[model samples]
Target chain A: MSITREEVLKMAELARLEFSEEELDGFTAQFQGILDYIEQLRQVDVEGVEPTSHVSLSADFDPRMFREDEARESLPVEEALGGAPDPAAGHFRVPKVL
Target chain B: MSLRRIEEADPALGAFLTCDPGRVLERAERVDRDVKERPLPLAGVPVAVKDNICTRGLRTTCGSRMLEQYVPPYSATAIERLEAAGAVVVGKVNCDEFAMGSSTENSALQVTRNPYDLDRVPGGSSGGSAVAVAAGMAALALGSETGGSVRQPASFCNVVGLKPTYGRISRYGLVAFASSLDCIAPLGNSPRDIALLLGRIAGRDPLDSTSAPAPVPDYVAELDRPPGRLRLGVPKEYFGQGLDPEVKAAVEAGIRNAGKLGCDVVEVSLPHTRFAIADYYIIAPAEASSNLARYDGVKYGFRAEAPEDLMDMYRRTRTLGFGPEVRRRIMIGTYALSSGYYDAYYGRAMKVRTLIRRDYERAFEKVDALLGPVSPTAAFRIGEKASDPLSMYLSDIYTVTANLAGIPAVSVPCGFTAGGLPIGMQILGNLFQELPLLRLAQAYIREFPVAPPPLRV
Candidate 1:
C-alpha cells in the first residue's frame, strides 16, 4: 500500500498543488503511513452492504422540499466579482489558455 | 460589556480571529431598541462564531492563509436566525485550517490554547469557540462539526457542545469540508444556552437543500420533564483500549449516576466501531477534494503575484495558501477519487460507513440513547500530537460515530481529571432526537454542576 514518489507527484498535480523536494520527501513518507492505516478498511467484509453517500438520508429525508426550479434573481455582477483577484469588464480575468 | 471582557481575556486565550466592536455595538443598540416592544430570546447576548461560518461583511478565514482576507458577501442562515433573535455578534473565533485536524494546532493563522490550561490545546477545529465560552468571553458560540470538532473541544474546555442530527441545522453558508458529515452546532456554558441557540438555528432552509424539514422543538422546555427510566446503552467498544483510565472512570461514574437518576444503563456493542477513522478519512477527503476545487486563483481569496500560466498559478496558490495538513488531506482525497483507485478507496469506505450507521440503528432499537467519553483523554499539551497525524486522528474515536450515524449528540462536563483538566461524557440519541439528548445533558449538568475555567486576565 506504499505510495511511490511518482504517484505523489501525480496526486499533487491532480490536486493543483506543488511541493518542494523536501516537502515531497516528507509527504511521501507520511502518505505511506496514512495509506497503511487506511488499508485496514480492506479487512471489513462489505460484501453486499449498500454504500451510504449521505448519512442524513438513511431514515427521514425528502427531496421534494427543494426550492422550485423557477428563475430567481442572482448576485449583482459587481458584488459577484468583488473578491476576484483580477477582473475585466464584468468578468473574471485568467491567464490565457489558448 | 462582552467586548470589554473579550478584549481583556482573549489575548491570554487566542480564541478570536476577528472582532468588530463597531458592528457589535450597532447590533446591540438595535436589539435594545426592539426589545422594549417584543421579547427576544437572546436579546443583547454576545455570541462568537467559529471562523468557518460565514458572516456578511466580516472576514471568515477558516483559519487559512488562502482566505486571509476573504470576506463573505452573505451570512449563513444560522447566523441570520441568531441575529434576528437579538444575539449580538461578538467576533469570529479560530479553528483548524478548513476544520481538518483534531487540534487547533493546524490553524494557519494562530493557535488557540485551552482556557483551563494555557499549556494544553482546547481541542478543535472548534477550539476557539470552546475557549471563548470556557473563559467567559462570549455567552454562546457557533461551531461546525465534521467529526468531533465541537464536542471534543467542549470536553477539553469544560463547556456544553451539542451537535444536532445531520441536516438539523442549515448549512447554507458553511465552508464545506465533508458535506455529508458537516453539522452546525452550538457551544455554551450551560445546556439551557446550548438549547436556546439550537432551538433558534435548527430548521430547514431553502438555501441548503440537505436541511431536514423536521419541526423544531422547544429544547429549553424539554429540560423540565425528568428523564424517566430511559434505556441508556453503554457501547462496549468505547471503553476498550486507548481510552485514558481517568476519562473511563469519569464516564463510568457518570453512567452509574445516570442509573441513580432512573436511567437504565445497559451494555451494547457497535462491532464495526474500529473502522470509523479509516472510513472517515477516505469519505471526508473525497468530498473535500471536490468542494475545495473552487479555491483556484481566479475568482476569490489569495492569488499568487504572477505566474507563467494558469496551471502554475493554481499549483503555486494552493501550495502556498494551504498548510501541510490541508495539503495532505487534498492529496489523500485526490488519490481516493482518482480514476484507477476510486473503488478501492472511496467506494469501500462508503460501504464501511453503511455498516457503522447500521450498528447505531441496531443499538438505538433497544436503547433510548447511548453514552460514552467525548474524547480518549483530557486536553494534551499544544505540540503533543502535532508530529503524529494518525495518533491525532485516533483521539476522535469515540465522537466520530455520532457524525457517521447522522445522530444528535451532546457533550457535558462529567468530571475533572487528576491533572485538573476537564473530562466530558457524550450522550447520543437517534436521528433528530435532539430534545431528549439535550434533556439528558441538562439533567447531568444539574447534578454535576461544572465550574468555569479559572481564567483571570
Candidate 2:
C-alpha cells in the first residue's frame, strides 16, 4: 500500500502535530516502512476471533471491579492547576478557540 | 551506599535525569526516623524511579521535552506504596521519550549508556532504571513497560526485571504510553530484591480500577519455596530466526539449568508469535495516540510560544514538545485508529492479540511456565539502529508478546557473550502467577549465578 504526502499531512492534522519539510520526508519514508511491516497482520485469519480491547476485559465483566463513583478527597484545585502552562482565574488559559 | 555510588558514577553513566542528593538524604533520614516507631519492610532502601512514573513534586519528564519540567501533582500508586514501606526515592531516571522507544537514545533529555559497555545502548525505555540498579546507584528501581521496556534493559544491564501480570500493579499515576499494555515493573540486582519490590507495589488500588482484585502473594517468601518437578516450556518460536547465536546459546544453557533443577523441559509452539510485533505496534500506538491527545498546550506541559489560534498552538506545541519517535508513534496511532482504516489495522490487530494471548493460554495448560530469551541480542552500539526505526522495533521481537498476553514475565541473568555483554533468560507465567515465576528464577539463579559486568563506573 503506497502512502501519499497528502495522507501524511492529513494524519498530521488529525494527530494535532506539525512536521518540518525535512522531518516530514523522513517520517513519511519510515512510516511507509512500518506500514509495510505491519501489513503482515492482514494475513491472519481473524474471522470469528474476538477482538481484545484490553486484557482486563478478556475476563467476564464484573461491575464490582469499578470503584464507587461517590466523590472523595481529591487534589485541591490549586494543585490540579499547578502544572498548567497557562492558568487564570480558576481555569487553564488557552488561546481563543472561537 | 547507593547515594555515594550515584555521586561517584552517575556523572559518567547518565543513568539519572534527576538525582537530588540532598532530597534523597532527607528521605533516607526520614525513613530511619520512622523505623523507630514501626518497622517498615523496605526500611531505608534506596530506589530509583523511571521518569514516566509520577513522583509528586519531582519532574516526571517521560524523557520528552514536552514534560521537561512537568512535576506531577500526585505520586503513582507504586511510588506511594514504596515510600510507605520505607523505601527512599533516589532519583528519577531517564527513559525513551514518553517510553516510546526500545533504546534510551530516544531520550530527548539525556543519554544513558549501558554500564556494561558505555559505547552500547542500554536496552530501554527503562534503560536508566536498569543502569541505576546494575551500577549500584540504587538497590531497587521502578520501571514501566509497554513493550520490552523493563525486561530488555534488565537483560542488557544484567539486573533482574519483572513485568508482573497485567493489573498486578496499579497504573494510577504512571504516565500512560499504551493504557492496555502498560505495566509498572521492578528492576533489581537479584530476584529477591525484585520480589520484595513487587510485593510492596502489587495489590488492588481503588485509584486504578484495572488493578486486579486478586490477593497479592508474598513474593519474597515465594522465592524460598522449592520449584519441584515444574513443567518448563521452551517456546520454539522464540528461538527462531533473528535470535543472536550467543543469546541463543546462553538461553539454552538456562533451559538446561532448569532441567537440572528437576524441571520437565519441553519444546512448545506459540503459533501466533510472529504476528506479535505487527499487532503490538498497531495496538500500542493506537492507544498511545488517544492517551497522548490530552497533552495539548492547554492544561499541562510545553506550549508553543506564539500561535494565531488554538489549533495552531496544539499543532506547533506537540511538534516542538515531542521527540521524533514519539511523533512517529502518534502519527501511526492516529492513522490506525482513524476512520475507514480502523478495522483493517486496530481492529484486526486486536483480534491477532487474542490469538497471541490464546497461544500463551494453551502453552500454560501443558507447562507451568515458559522460558526463552529476553532480547534477540545484548546491548548494541548507540546510534546503530537510531536512524532505522524498523530495526529498533525488531529488537523488541521477543519481549512484546508478554505485554500482549498480559502475563507475568521476569528477566533472569543467564550467561554472557564471549565479548562479555550480558544475556538474559525470560521466564513467563500464567496470569497472576508471579510467585512461581519468581521462585523458578530464584532457583535458577541459585544454581547458576552469572557474574556482574566489570563495573566501569
Q: For chain B alone, what TM-score does every candidate structure achieve against the true structure?
A: 0.99, 0.99
Clashes of 2: 0
Off by over 4 Å in 1: B451-453
* Segments of candidate 2 deviating more than 4 angstroms: A60-63
**TM-score for all models, in order of appearance:** 0.99, 0.99
Q: Per-residue CA lDDT of candidate 1, range B45-138, in tens? A: 8999999999989999999999999998899999999999989989999999999988899999997888778899999989999999888889
Interface RMSD for each candidate model? 0.9, 1.4
CAPRI quality level assigned to candidate 1 from its DockQ score: high
Fnat, model 2, is: 0.93
The best candidate by DockQ is: 1
